[model samples]
Target: MIMVNRFSRLIGTLIDRAAALQHIASQCILCAAPGQKGLDLCLPCQLDLPALTQCCQQCALPLFDHKAYCGQCLLSTPAYQRVEAPWLYQPPIAQLISRFKYSRQYSIGKVLSNIAARRYASAYIDQKLPDLIVPIPLHWSRQTIRGFNQSEHLARYYSHHFNIPMKRFLKRCRPTAAQQMLTADQRRSNMKGAFQMCGDVAGKLVAVVDDVMTTGTTVSEASQCLLKAGATEVHIWCLARTE
Candidate 1:
C-alpha cells in the first residue's frame, strides 16, 4: 500500500510538471509563434479571425443589417428555436476545422472547441442553459470509416463547460450523400428521415451540437427528430457558419 501511494503521487507530480512545460513551450498552431493565454493561437490572430457578429437570431445566417430573423426563417420556421455560432467559416477558422475534421488532428479540435466554449459561455449568461447536449450523429458506416464523430467531440466540450448531460438521443437511421456535394434544396431533401430519436426527450430543452453549419439542413433534421420525440425546444450550437 505504501509503495502504491508513493507511485501515484510521483505520477501526479510528473503530469503536473508536463502540463506546465507544455504551457511554457506552446506555439500558435497557425503562425508558429508563441501562444497566448494558454491557447494554441496568438492574440493578433485570435482577434483577426472571422467573427459571426451580425446574423439571424433563428438560423444564424450572416445578415447585411441587424435583423431579428432571416427572411427564409420568417417564411419557414425551423424546428430549432435558435442558433449560436462564434465564428464565420472563413480563413484560419476554416483551416482549423478542416484539420480537426479531416486530418484527425484532435489537438487542433481541442483548441477550436475551447475558444468556442468560452465565447458561448459569455453569450448565454442571460439565457438558460439547456437540459441536455445532443451531438449530430453520423451514420454507423461512416462513423466506422472515419473512426470517430467530430460533432461528438464538440458536444463533449459543451457538456463539460455547461455542466449539462450529453446524450446520444439521435442516430442517423440511414446513410446519405455528403451534404457538401449537394445543392441547398438537395441537402434538405437528402436529410429527410435521416435521424431518429433513440431516447425520450419529452419536454426537455436540448442543445444540438455540430462542428459547422452550411445550409443548416443536417441540424434541422436532427432537431425535427428531437421535436417529434416531444422535446420542448431545440437550439443549435456550432463552431462556425458559412456566410
Candidate 2:
C-alpha cells in the first residue's frame, strides 16, 4: 500500500506540472499573440474572427438582420431545446476545431470548452447543468482510429465550471460513416441510430457537448438515444455553429 501511494503521488505531481505547462489562460489559439486577461484571442485575431450575430435561439443558425428562427427551424423544430455557440465556423476557429478534433490538439479544446461552459452558460443553462454531461459518442472503430472522442475531451474542461458530473453516457454500437466526408443529406442518414445510452437518463436533463453544429444531425441523433433512455430533455453546447 505504501509503495502504491508513493507512486500515485509522484504521478499526480507530474500530471499537475504537465497540465500547467499545457494550459494557456490568455492566448490566442490562432496566432501566438499575447491576449488580455481572460481573453481567448489576441486583439488581431479577436477582431478578425467572424461572430455569428442574429442567430436563432432554438436552432442557432445565422439570421440576416432582425430574424429569430432560420427558415428551416421554423419549418421544423430540433429535438434539443436551445443551442449556444460563441462564434461562426470560419478560418481561424475552423482551424482550431480541426486541430482539436483531427490533429489531437487537446489543449485547444480544453480552453474552448472552458469558455463554452462559462460564456455560453445561461441561467437556465446554469440551472440545467444537468445530472451529467453526455458527450456525443463516437463509434468504437472511430475511437480506435482517432484515439479519442473530441466532444468528450472538450466537455471535461467545461464541466469544471458547471459543477455537475460529466461522463461517457453514450456508446457507439456500430461504426457509422464520418460526417465530414458525406453530403448534408447523407450525413443525416448516416448518423441515424449511431448512439446508444449506456446509463439511465430518465428524469435527467443532459447537456450534450460538441465542437460544432452544422446540420444539427449528430447531436440530435444522440439526443434521441438519451430521450429513448428516458431523459427529460437534451440541450447542446458547442464552441461554434456555422450559419
lDDT of 2 by residue, 38-92 (tens): 5555767766767767789788887777887777878988888878788899877
State which candidate has the highest TM-score: 1
- Candidate 1 residue runs with Cα over 4 Å from true position: 1-19
Instruction: List the RMSD of every prediction in angstroms.
Output: 3.5, 6.4
Q: Locate the minimum summed-lDDT window of 10 residues in model 1.
A: 36-45
In Å, residue 156's CA in model 1 sits off its true spot by 1.1
Candidate maximizing lDDT? 1
- With a 3 Å backbone cut-off (N, CA, C), the pairs that clash in candidate 1 are none
What Cα-based lDDT does every candidate model obtain? 0.90, 0.79
TM-scores for every candidate against the unseen true structure: 0.90, 0.81
lDDT of 2 at 140: 79
